[model samples]
Target chain A: MAAIMAKPSLKTLKCTQCGGAIELRGGHNVRSIVCQYCGSCLDSKDQFKLIHKFLNQKRPFMPLKIGASGKLKGILFTVIGVLQYEEREAGEFFRWLEYLLFSPTHGYVWLCFEDGHWVMMHEVKDLPETQVEIVSPRKTRFKARDKTFKVFENAQAHISYVEGELTWQAKQNEKILYLDAVCPPYMYSIEMRGSEQEFFWGEYISVKDINAGFRIESFEPATVFSCQPFVVSPLFEALSKGALIASVITLVMYFLISSSGTPVMQHHFGNQLFADGETSKEFKVDKPGSLYGITVHTPNLKNAWSFFDVRVVDRDETNKLFTMPTTLSFYDGYEDGEYWSEGDTEVVSYFRIPEAGEFKLAVDGEGGTGEEPAEGFSLSGVNVSIREGVRLGHYTLTWFVLCLLAAAPYFVKYMLFEQSRWHDDEEDDD
Target chain B: MAVMLTCPSCGNQITQITRSPQVLVCPACNTTSFLQNGRLEDVGKSAILTDIPSIFQINRTYRHKDWKFSPVGRVRYDYGDGWWDEWYVRGENGKESWVSVDEGEIAIEVLVQEGLNVPPFEKLSVGGVLMINRQRMTIIEKNRCTMIGAQGELPFKVIPNETYDYVDLLGPKRSSFTIEYQAGGVECYKGVWVDPFEIAEA
Candidate 1:
């Protein structure tokens, strides 16, 4: 048997919709062919049928260079074929390419050299549409406690670098046109260059633009950067201690009022009565009338008499010697003997005490039959004593004192060491 | 060997006929005839006209091995000295195919074989003469029928009488040609156009 080697199929078809060509198969199979240029597809068999025929004719080749220009988002751009260049070239071309690929939408044109490298850029106009306005550079000085430093004018707007050690003479053309880098730490410096000074500084300068145009006028250190220790004064400390003492006294008064109990006073008095027989009954005091008075006094006296008064009556009534009724009389004064008279009803009242206190009444009667003179009656004298009110305890006072003591140190330190308006002025000086 | 023939009705002269035992029909009276012993004899009225002429010819001899034209496609080949040869062929499927030739003979033969089918004639090159009738087309080279076209418009057709000023054949000389239906008249003629790549059997 002979082996039959099959040849690869060479007959191909072209897409009707998008002008792209493809290879065909047995019995004109209906397969989709997509145009590479426009991405249109021929899905149906009728659509894939070719209207024009092309013979597989062989021809020669030609070399040509072509370019295309188009607009994207209103920005005109030109795309060139591949470019070729040497490796050593300083990649300005590559930078231009990167700018084109990543830059914001702007009109750009690209060039392709024969070496297959590419360069793309926006066309450079005579002047930039936007420009920077620079004010004239000036010089200034800063002081921190004892340390002095010079800050060039316009330094706040930009960064400043020192051309040399702190010097009296100012450098020329202090303005900084561009900032390249910034160096840190205590000596804070900036690296900058200007178009006018480009030749003087060359490519870049370590320190060139600081303290350039204006006079230093005066040099001083900045207090914020100072590291000096602070000390407190004695007068302020004493004033703070006095404030704490006043606070302690006020706290003690508050505690005393809150802790003590209410105040009260007591007094007692007694009296006895007797009846006479025969013509007249006479009463006499066994103990002399000492005039015992119980008086209760406070800041307001009207409330003291509510508990002071007492009412008394005789219990025994005996023989006809009581034919004469006993009369009671009251005396207002001891010297003048002004008396209160009872008419038919035989009760007498003499005086009232302003405060609650015990008082005694003396009584005497005329005897009608004159027997043995009436037996004498007597009343006992009252007793009274003054007592102190209950007091609040001492621990409350001690706690108040302790609270004041606890706050004293912080108060003293704040008064003496904290910075004030006057201290800010002092810090501003070198 | 070749045969010379005279038209039976018009007595017009014809020569260099092939020994392939083929028939010819005269353009004057439409006489059906065959070549015998270096002369032409008329067959009876039952004989009918059969061969036609081709206006365009393939100038190369060999055909490409891989060349195939389905429909509308174009191919190009590079010749030496920066010249290009191109071919476009229209197919029955209403598709076109193009092939290009370059400096090498093997590449040219491959392109030719892919583009054209086998000619039912013989030994035809550039500068050959063609005879046409209602039925068949024939190619005469050196006054002999070196190639023949089958009757009835062959499976594929060419635009007739369309001449090309091939740079290789004439060395920068220009030419004009036209294509027409045999019964009607010439359709269109193009003057001084570059020669097209040759077609051959695959």
Candidate 2:
């Protein structure tokens, strides 16, 4: 309905049908005005010409009457009209109320009341015609908004009652068809009339906000609308946002701290040749630790893989046992017109060593073949290099898993919100 | 614009195509008369039109979904509450259709030709659905409406105060079908709903 901002006129006209006093608090622009006493639809433009004498006053529940003033967005607006609409689906009737509010400066806007939730809306004149029904391929776009909206409710609604001044001739029980899409706190609606279509942009308002805006003592509806913005639980939104930021900060910290790590000790066994099950001289460790990385480099191995199973025993009186298994494989061969090579000749294993001390190194080789002794490809004969330090990969992997665990809840929450909005158009796959 | 006729009472002449049994309220003197057999028979009636704000008016040019239309006539239906206006229009491709506007909704209706087998009116229920012409359409409402007024060229005569019962059905892609039951015959109309804002911008 098109309404304009006009200065308030003190002129009050008697309803031609009922002689009831009528005031133009909505402004001179309102075309149809209903007599509050007799419920006569009058043509406000043409001397309050009687349009229809409405009977069957099964009035829908409305807490406020026409001409009630409310302040919206700090602007004072007077209620000009009220309309009750009901949509029937699946053997049930869903009803909602709409109040037409007029600010002498802001013209007219609608305050929709349904399921105890309120939405304020204004007429929208243009939208891509192609967006008739949820834009099929693109589910979330409404007009020019960056967020995509899901279908809130799509049903045919009918006007059940009208009161006071309205932009159009107020109907008693006229049918209206509309499709509502929500990006919550915002809703985009397309209404269909005979051959004319209209658009409305709606914003979800809290009951508290409504009461404050209207300066009402309280407005507490018994039931909540299924499409209420907070139905998804705002707690989930806060949790997801907070967790996402925390994960990013933790990731940065992990990268910085992990990169600055240095090896605590290093050992070279290049000069000493060792055989299988051979134990080397004890390397004294100045510090005792929980976990250490045992790195071994067996140089120049070919055509096979070599694995060493190691046992770590503390040299102290109480020799607690800790063991780690490492693999070093280097394979090169030519067959079937293609040359293939695989497996690194060096490997590292990180494990707990009870406590650091005089740690002895043992070399046990298995499954090494097809190479000369000089090439160091045979088992039981290769150099070993050991580095005992904080394992960056181990701690980094632990933090990465922790990050994933933290993100899982947020991901599920996003899907749940989408599920609630998509409840109408889609059946849950689950 | 079609055939020109003189208002029997006021002698005002205007181009119009009157359906066989409709009353014409003289655009000049507001004299209402029944047009029967190429002659105006005085019925002595007039209507005080509630000013309806609409961009799609009589003889106005507009485009809807690739088809250009020129509104020729209108028939307003009174369903006890308010008026529902169905504008008789012709497409650029020479197809005659009805465009209805009530509240802010805009939908076009094209008369379904032969070959559709629809059940009797009594068999249709508000919540019941049926497959018509291979499209699944759900019945929304069934109403009995009377002719309130009309203007200009029309395909069917605007019988003064004639009542008809119709059922409204909705289908996929915003397509809706109307099953109108009349005394002599039944007329079936189907069309897709459109957004007025989409076309207003176009």
Candidate 3:
């Protein structure tokens, strides 16, 4: 339902049906003018004859009134007419407002408001060239004014209401098939009625800009529109780039700072040392204070257990002892006619060398074969190997993990924005 | 040489600005007269046009970019939906052109000479295609406009309330053409759309 109001006449004329003063702003070009006060459609060309009258029509929400002037694209335009169209697709009803704007030199332009989004449109005489893909036949492309647009929507829209002065005689429920194509921030609409086809090109305008142009209050957008472009702030862009660069630099520096560890000590001892209950060895740590790895292997110890206490002393007369307690166990027997082994035969551990000097390593051990080692149990042989300056992986991993954590939120939001833009297409895929 | 004639309706002396024009409307009494057999003939009275907001005026020199012309005559046509004005102007080089003003749209057109094949008006339809002067054009609008009034001196005779059919064709790059069907066969005019903001008083 549409109720219109017009004021301030260029040529003051009275409506024949309702005797209401109708103002004509489009000069002689206006074919029909509706009585704003009485809802009577009057012929503007033939002495304001009564064509028809709208009865009990509800007035829809309109932001701009007829005869209201606003500046658009550097030209002053007046709202002379408005048409409300409703599109019913798949049982869903969609309504939009179209305001016909008039400028003395620029002719006419339409501003369409839908779902709190505004689009400024102009009827284009030049039609776009269309191409259909051989693969994926549902995808249609239109090329116009050097921009390619993909088909976004296809539906039929009907004129629900008409108001004010119009160039042509408009009636209720006039159906027209429309095809919409989008190229981001711009869209092309092809409307067909019988044999007459009209092309309209439109550009998406921000609510802030539209409000400022009309000097009206702000209109909040209900949701993201199809043609609404994703805008990234400069700070966000800089931070994203900086994080990526920092991660790469940290990885490269970690590799440059690490190396393979050098061998420092190797020795083999017989079970006689364990039988004596103690052993000691002096080794030179030639490198500066760094991490060192020590490995102990007992190849010949079978079905036996051993407990040992090891210490590293500075050998500087301070006799500072570093205690390391270790347990080695191995057992094998036939279970269900299959052989199985338990416990480990080798163990490795890491320690930091305090300084580059001589260090004395001492070990004392007890061994057993079955339950009590005091009864009778002995180890065969043992091997000890140590290496200096080994690389640690956690340093590089920590920096990489931190960078990923910092960027996850922004990346997820961007992905969601793109997914929302193609939400209709994704639903079709499902 | 300029020939001065007296208006048959008002008996006022009127001078012919250009020798090619056979019709001239009296500025004083709004009476239309035609030159025939070296004598002025009364052709009834022309309607006094209402003053609408317009950018160009009769007898005023207007400059559009590099081209300068002064409107010597005007004809108003009522084409159902709206009325458009055709200003007959004489260029600075003494040539003539037609400037059409429809609402805010303005175009500078010149008469295309005969010898080019033109299609009949009856077969023309809106959005139809046409080949005129070796250029592919599309028929944008077809209108049967009635000449409501005329003022000043025109190059051709203009009859009051004379209805004629014309088709407007648009070519590539804003090139426009109009084919008018009259009692004497058909006439074509070719031109380009002009920016109204660039037009200034010379």
**Maximum-TM-score candidate:** 3
lDDT of 1 by residue, B96-178 (tens): 33333222111111122222222232334445433322212222111111111111111122222222222111111122222
Ordering by TM-score:
3, 2, 1
- Write down the TM-score of every candidate: 0.14, 0.48, 0.58
Deviation in Å, model 3, residue A365 alpha carbon: 22
Q: Could you give candidate 1's per-residue lDDT for residues A1-430 as a string of tens digits? A: 1111123343555556555564432111123333333433344344454322212212212111222333322233323221111121234331111111111112122221112212122221111112212232222233321233232212212211111101111122133342111011112122234432210001110111111111111222233221112324667656556657766776767665542332122333332222321111222222232222222222121111111222211223222111112332222223457543321211212222233222222222222113333334322322222222334445556766676776678675554543431264345553
> What are the Cα lDDT values of the candidates?
0.28, 0.67, 0.77
Isolated chain B TM-score per model: 0.25, 0.85, 0.92
In model 2, what lDDT does residue B28 have? 59
Question: Which has the greatest DockQ?
Answer: 3
Q: If both were scored by lDDT, which would come out higher, candidate 1 or candidate 3?
A: 3
Shift in Å, residue A220, candidate 1: 18
Superior candidate under DockQ, 2 versus 3: 3
* Deviation of model 2 at A147, angstroms: 5.3
Tens digits of per-residue lDDT, candidate 3, A1-430, equal: 0111123337677778777776667655668887767878788777778788765556689988888888776667889988889987678999999998887656777889888888888776546755522121223776876788877777778887788888777765778887777787888888887656777778888888778888888678868776776667878867876777777777787788765578777777666657664444667787767788777788876788887776777665357558777778898999999999999888877788767888866666777786666544556668777788887666886896777667666678777986887787889889
